[model samples]
Target chain A: MAVRNRLTGERTHVPSAVGRRSRVASGPHDRHHEIIDAALELFATIGYSGTTMAQIGDRLGMRGPSLYKHIASKQELLVEIVTGMMDELLRRQRAALAEGGDVRQRLSSIVAVHVQYHAEHRYEAFVGHREIDSLEEPHRSHILDLRREYESRFRELVQEGRGLDLFRTSSDRWSSYAILDMGIGVSAWYNPSGSVTPDELAATYAELALRMLGAERGD
Target chain B: MAVRNRLTGERTHVPSAVGRRSRVASGPHDRHHEIIDAALELFATIGYSGTTMAQIGDRLGMRGPSLYKHIASKQELLVEIVTGMMDELLRRQRAALAEGGDVRQRLSSIVAVHVQYHAEHRYEAFVGHREIDSLEEPHRSHILDLRREYESRFRELVQEGRGLDLFRTSSDRWSSYAILDMGIGVSAWYNPSGSVTPDELAATYAELALRMLGAERGD
Candidate 1:
């Protein structure tokens, strides 16, 4: 069966292996990454449900058949985008924790990094927050588990801070939620081009997190 | 022009005033309010772009033509839902401020009420936050102005608190954003059926907000 390319309107019998390999041979980078980027841009802008495969193809100057050669489905793109973001976040957070500070310093570092990530990578953050419900099945459960693990870092920091008498919190769980939520909210409005730089916003949020946890001023 | 009712299998020449009046005669309430409620639920659950007038009519056991009698269009429903929420929030916040206390007490009352509103009216909050971008023209600007006016309340409190030496904040602007964002986040995750009651959540956040401002514990 002949398939008409959505972008160029050219007829292709199918997504040929030669066609896929030839596209990458002409460029140093793989088409898979490009496809994901286009999908992410569309998903973040028009929303997951509002976007279509044809639009993603149109964005990339690729036909529908060729686009499928790189991605299994739109849902796959969402899964890739969300899961990729979570993995990177977990990796960065672990590195921040490993650099090691006292509880106050450690919490401040993590909060700063969290705020910075949300501000710098606002599109990814927006999609992850908005399209979590759009994720399907095992990917949905897996991403949620990863998120819970990420949140546990904050919870543990608060618990350790409280134990050391450095942080005064009425409830450890709620305090952690408040800190994380405030940072997450940054993505909704933070502009890198604005007066406040990402680093500056991160530092401001870090101080706010410490205050919310009731850390002593002298400490 | 004849139109088919999406809900009930009937033909209506047009939205009849007598038909519209008869529906309300059976009850003491207006269909306009009920239509808004159904639209709110659909907008919050599916999304503004994803929801349809037919689906809203189906939710209310009314037909499309009759539904049109109560609302001008889907955009009108959105404008009402979002503007109504902002108006109600402004009213409640003004009342909270009017029942004034010291800076700490006033801020606490406002934060508590903010959290409570988000927790209890989660759907309205969700729609307002998610669908703000979907708003059109004059309504979009109108709602945003109302939001700015509402946010000014928080900024003013922080400014007042700082002036009186009751609150210590690194940046008055950042501190207010943190407090408001944290409370707004509650709408995304708060569960009325959960072990934590709305009042409990509000009180916890209020304390957090106070601490964030660096209010003295003794006060």
Candidate 2:
């Protein structure tokens, strides 16, 4: 059977009907996205070790071999999902940094992006938090690199705020960790059907984060 | 070969000396603690659904049937572990509250207790965060009740601080969640061999929590 590797844009496995559907359902930019979506649901439910290719295949209505058409291995699939989430997070942070607004606005935008992204893509966030370690050595290190880059964005913002005398925190990294912790925790319990919308939740968290940063009320 | 029921305070399953030593080397209290420890480790690694009696038994160097002699079922074991952790948390909170300090001091003590407990009992903390949903109806509700009660301690502290005009946050419950999230995240990535000791880490977090609560710097 001829294998077409959708991930690397190379030929590795035969394009079965399931693989064909995955390719067709997701446009060129979305192929990786669909695999991540399926992975998130499976990882959240059965956890990283317990979830197998066959189970993810079942979820996507693909045969076990057909899954290989999209990705090389289970570990690759996990790496793709976690990397994708972290990449998007980094993208938002970069945008916030480049926007060059006041510290308050920039910080608010950061919190908003975090809360909105996690709320909209809860499965990815959940899996990223819980299952990233399951990836093999190179893949795991790559994910960690992305995570550290993402975290550095917040740390930089906090340090900048402190430098400008806008805040007075003892340690900028721990403060940033605390804020990110709150944002990540939203995935565990926040529900769209609940009273608060994602935007509102983000705004609320922004206010709380700003306060935590020692921003005055008018700031 | 009678099996001794070490858990129920009855000798229902009195095993032979060899079997007893191989099955449960620890005394009743020690054996129960060992089971909880084993369950916590398994649950943290594989999650609740992914872990089975056989896997936990393997951790204890026993077969599935041998585990049954100590605990009625996997669910029972999970309940005991979760409840034990929660009970310890509540005791810590009560002790902190009973220290009879002002709001900031009391809040700092609470944060220290929370971070220290979660850092020391990392596996149990992971299970408490991730696997509470897999519990059955009554057990699930009972665990949730314990969680809600535990959460209320933080909320009450925040509310008292608010009454004293210490906190500037809008929602007490949300602030409580924020503080708890920081402490919970400690279990996810804390390394004792790293730069910070658990006590120092807890102190750092306690300072951040106090700042988030808008407590006076000196207080």
Best by DockQ: 1
Instruction: For candidate 2, give the DockQ.
Output: 0.33
What's each prediction's TM-score? 0.82, 0.73
Error of 2 at A30 (Å): 9.7
Every candidate's DockQ is 0.53, 0.33
Error of 1 at B176 (Å): 1.6
Which regions in candidate 1 have their CA more than 4 angstroms from the true location? A1-30, A52-69, A217-219, B1-30, B53-58, B61-66
Cα RMSD for predicted model 2: 9.2
Q: For candidate 2, lDDT tens digit of each residue in B1-219?
A: 565555655645544445444445456536667777887888887677767888877876667778867678888888888888889999988998899888888888999999988788888887887777677789889889988888888889899989988776777877888899889988877776777777887898888788777677662
TM-score of chain A of 1: 0.85
lDDT of 1 at A62: 60
Residue-level lDDT for A143 in candidate 1: 87
Best by TM-score: 1
For model 1, residues B12-38, the per-residue Cα lDDT tens digits are 455334544455465645778888888
List model 1 lDDT by residue over A1-219, tens digit each: 655455576644653345444554656457788888888888887789878888988877766666877778878899999998899888889999999979999999999999999998888888888888788889889989999999999999999999989898989988998998898888878777889988899998998899889897653
lDDT of 2 by residue, A1-219 (tens): 555555655645554454444445457436455566776788877677767777777766666677776777777778778888888888877787788788777887898889877777777888888776577788788888888878787888899888888877777877888889889988877777887777777887887788778775553
Q: Where does candidate 2 stray beyond 4 Å?
A: A1-80, A102-108, A134-138, A163-165, A215-219, B1-32, B46-76, B100-105, B216-219
